[model samples]
Target: MITQEKYRTTVKELLANGTIKMAIGYRPGSTPDRRRPLFIRTSEEADQLVLDSTCITNLSGYLVTEGLLSDEKQVGIFLRPEGIRSINILAAEYQLNVDQIVIFGFDSTGREVRPLQGRNAGDFSALLTEIKENPPLTSKEPLLERVEKMNAKERFDFWQEEFSRCIKCYACRQACPMCYCRRCIVDSNQPQWINTSSHTLGNFEWNVVRAFHLSGRCVQCGNCDRACPVNIPLRLINQRMAKEVVDGFDHFAGLSPTQEPVLASFKKDDTETFIL
Candidate 1:
């Protein structure tokens, strides 16, 4: 297990050496067991860094925040396995430059905090490959299994019921690293692609559109899931879409920076069973 002191010492060295202009990691939250994102510019602030299972918030979303990375200086970020995948997705989609960010990778599984070796996102290719080849059993959530058992109508009804509680808060959109759009479809009032109201039809449209937008690009970080105030199973929708992309296009999202997004790429021999 990587101790807090070791993590702090490493971050301090990186800061002192001018390897990064800023470091983004976790600090203690309001509650005892909670952790929140912390941005540190000085080596002395390194002591505030902490890593644990509660450090689950994917800080990759902050990487593409407005003017956050505009200074042309290298920025360091503490990343989990999923967060690294988000970085790859961001690079592939041209949202950010992969070379400008330095990764301090760590995996906090169960109660242990393990350090990962990688200066850049591509450095952990082997580890990512291993994870893709052999996913951990714990990766499958029980809620997803239950949802799979429902019939088509039942599933639709389930989603309808869940979406009814939506208040169009847009928290899910804000929390997602892949949803870096300046103007979402629902926000477009010129043509009114989707209704912005929180009524049943509008809510359904918002949720479905959000899911489809993230269909092939989602990194399964569960940030959107946690950000929803209504406790909707947003991650399940993303996981199901990811599974379909894999089975249909043989494409996995964010595996490599060079890989094309599943939805964006088209092939001559692609399957079209759904087409009449």
Candidate 2:
């Protein structure tokens, strides 16, 4: 309870101080299952912020607006594991300056915060010890086995079947905090990359483009999967892409805020079996 409250309170303080131009988070929206982005610019507004299982929309998704912020001002973010992954992608792509943002990381204790050593060590130490002792549940260790358990053909056919149910609502793209392109390829009129119709080919092309674009950059946060109105298991794409990045480039999580997004750059010795 303390950790979750810490995140909520600190965010409220920053908003009250006017330190951040705006603090974006989630509160219960118009309906029970819906949660809207709560942008708090005042202490009273900040007080309205809440954290719970219903918080799913990536706050980073709002960071990509036109005239979003003054370059001179800094932004503070409340990050879950997946939100942090979005930060990694943004940092690597050079789309946003990492130095201008502050991150607040919290671990859910299955619902509430657990007291660590009577609050003995500070949050950082407590987090470090917990992290060192027990690995993150989001780690890709379980994914590789699930992949190996299935044959190649089964895997391919599996995705085709799952993605075939797609309604092409573009919720996956909208929920993604990293997909900030002003004019998506699908919407481009110069030459349509994929038809706007909800055809299988269009859906496949859209998903393929999304996956290939995210390749090494995906953080595997599962927001896209959650956002799918049709309930597609879109995290499979994230998991597969993460596995590919690990297997192909030996690169894993983007821990450093200053590190370049890896998939955007190519090394001279990169493998290219399909090139010829």
What lDDT score belongs to each candidate, Candidate 1 first? 0.86, 0.67
Look at candidate 2 and give me any clashing residue pairs. 1-113, 92-261
Model 1 backbone overlap count: 0
What lDDT tens digits, residue by residue, belong to model 1 across residues 54-136? 78889999999889788878899999888998999999988889888999888865788888988798998888888777755
Candidate 2 displacement at residue 140 in angstroms: 10
The residue pairs in collision within model 1 are: none
Q: Give the alpha carbon lDDT tens digit for every residue of 1-276 in model 2.
A: 455577667777766676677777767789886777777676677666667666656677677676665465767666665566566567666666666666665435555533232211122344443432453666445755686688989877776777789988898988887778888888896888787787777788899898887777666666787789987767777777776776777655454455555665668888888896
For every candidate structure, what is the RMSD over all alpha carbons to the true structure, in angstroms?
1.5, 4.6
